[model samples]
Target: MDPNEVPDDDAATSGGALPRRAPGPPRPAPIAEIDALSGDPSFMTSLARGLAVIRAFSERRKSMTIAQISQKTGIPRAAVRRCLFTLAQLGYVHDDNRSFSLLPKVMSLGHAYLSSTPLPVMAQPFLDHVREALHEACSLAILDGDDILYIARSATTTRIMSVDLKIGSRLPAYCTSMGRVLLAAMPQAELDAYLLREELKPLTDRTITSRASLLQALAAVRQNGWAIVDQELELGLRSLAVPIHDTSGTVMGAMNVSVQAARVPVKELETRFLPVLLEASRELSMQLL
Candidate 1:
């Protein structure tokens, strides 16, 4: 078995086992913060711009030009260039010919979350328990713009997506069950703005790439209290999700179960998987509160 395909510990891996994906070409792992800049106020803009540039690189666009950076971030071209230059100089970014991309140094920011946040740590054992009981891969995700970031996973060994995503993995929310659950918790205005700002893109042939269709789906998700995504994110990967809310009813996050489509239908997800996920969501939410 490949190293990533093996169990990292005695703990069970979903479908039996392993993964992490590099952010991209010359793209360093995504580091969200600058350690040295924390104590100095002067490093603020340098820190902010550098982080913005790093965020600009994603699954949709892995490599970007200066103008693309400016367009994506709303920062001026000059400032984006300066940040890229500084990041490149620091070994945080790369410059080959004219294109620019992040490097592994970027992973520092993502690693910080895994390192410092207790939620993922607390959720791991619980996620494993749930997955084993359900016999499916489970994951915890937080909303980030129009996408969901996979903060923790009770992942199956199966390679389902075109890309490999481990913890800190991000995917467009409109198309995933986890995304809909989190989005369903959002206030009307915020949801409207997000829908307007982000034009959904087709990942697989089944993806809800249309704005109107996504809104309709979100409406149903809001009314139903859970989300079931069938092959929208990827073919043969069906998932069910539920909102995880805190004591005051604020949505803290979401939880998901990904199953092979051949094994379960969308109805089966709502019937069999939803209750388990809802129980886990409630427990996780209670823990946060």
Candidate 2:
């Protein structure tokens, strides 16, 4: 049996499982101390709010009014207006006198990161190789607070999930295969802190909401050095992930192969896909070293 595959009875071995709670809406991002930071000369509240305004725009929300930006970012309308005005003046935003939208200049910010970061550049060829070999979507993600942020990806035309995933996509850590692998690599105290603070809202029927169950699942990932999530993030999407380590053997991120759950069974994912994913992660890690 694959070491990553935990038997149904594994939950019974774990002590004191929390009672399952009814699913609720996903938790909102914690509000930053914008007011407190305004007093600090060293802290740049204006710059922070300006960045927040830029982040408010997404593929789904291409254009928005000042009121909508304020609502999305939790910034006051006065501050949001000032930030948008500054961004527009700087040629980063385009205003049609009604709704404001980001210009192509925004790509420069992401471009800077992609240009400087060796991880994405070095991992691209390996990611492409894995995608081509298995004919599945492959992605590289790093841990960002309680979420996994996709920094790189090689995808097929087929859509496996409800969300349109691309670079910069963020998903909850507790339920995703890449998220689990990254979480498993975290120090015990840090992992404990994350579990204490983040609410594990169920994203799907199979999502693990109980803290005990999640801890047990993470333990299995730690032991096996890989994670397989079956429709936990979204229905019909199953993924397998392995951690990418640096020269120091510290895990920096995770790489995953995603496939349609209807098309691939978990057994085949472990037997066939896991080896290729591990090989890709190893190749990427070698370059990092």
Candidate 3:
């Protein structure tokens, strides 16, 4: 059995439940992740290397040396240097002799996706409507890798989460309401692979770190057609989510309303917010069709 699934008897003998692990900040996708693709004729190794180098820079790591970039991305230093040089020449990055930082022109790369993708644009008014009705923050996101990537948001003045989230923000899929809904819609084989690979590290004491429990929670979501995650991602944050489907009734994304746990009860989320959320998602899904 996996260590993440602790038996009840074992937990009792251990005095208390196992300690929750707080994972470190997110890092760039390692080059090792794409190593299998190296042999594929269609795969663009140089482009992937350049993108990996770009991903190495973050809010905390505003600027980085070639060595630091290489270490973070698992690309060789020489490769990192070449990628950075190419990016600098393309006005995507700036190197000031010591460290390199992303330039303003880099915004275009993300802008291209946002402008071309109709989901965010179409979902904005619906998200805004939900936010106005609920007096809570509402967001639209899609399952990206093992995380949920926020694409659109309508936030109230009251900030619920510690981190200020906007478009491009990502959160772990296992513990988030939107993530659970998206996960629930996934095919069993894909879901099994995800559960096996993802580390169920707890972000809060209340977070369900057990893979078995998470599976049950996902099953419940599948049955109910919505997900309510109470203080799983953060101590005082609770979120409720419903799936947004496409024309063929395939789940395309998830939409959620987040509120402070202290201010709103789980009962309220299900009873009061669920209906309106369901309606908004239906409307958005129709729009997609």
Give the residue spans of candidate 3 off by over 4 A. 1-29
Candidate 1 stretches with Cα past 4 Å from truth are 1-48, 59-80, 95-101, 209-212
Model 2 C-alpha lDDT versus the unseen true structure:
0.84
lDDT of each: 0.76, 0.84, 0.86
Better of 1 and 3 by TM-score: 3
Q: In angstroms, how far off is 36's CA in candidate 3? A: 2.1
Ten-residue stretch with the least lDDT total in model 1: 27-36
**Residue range 80-152, candidate 2, lDDT tens digits:** 7778888999999999998999999988998898888899888899999999999989999999878898999
Model 3: per-residue Cα lDDT over 70-135, one tens digit each: 889867676678789999999999989999999989888888988998999999999999999999
Winner by lDDT:
3
- lDDT rank, highest first? 3, 2, 1
Better of 1 and 3 by lDDT: 3
Candidate 3: the clashing residue pairs are none
Give the least accurate 10-residue stretch of model 3, judged by summed lDDT. 4-13
Q: Tens-digit lDDT track for model 1 on 1-289?
A: 3342222212322232123544653221122223223334344545565667888887667788987886776555666777888889889888985788878988987888788877888788778978888887889999986789998888767766677767878888888888998888889899888876566778789999887788889889888988889898888888888887777998778888887899788888888888888888777877877
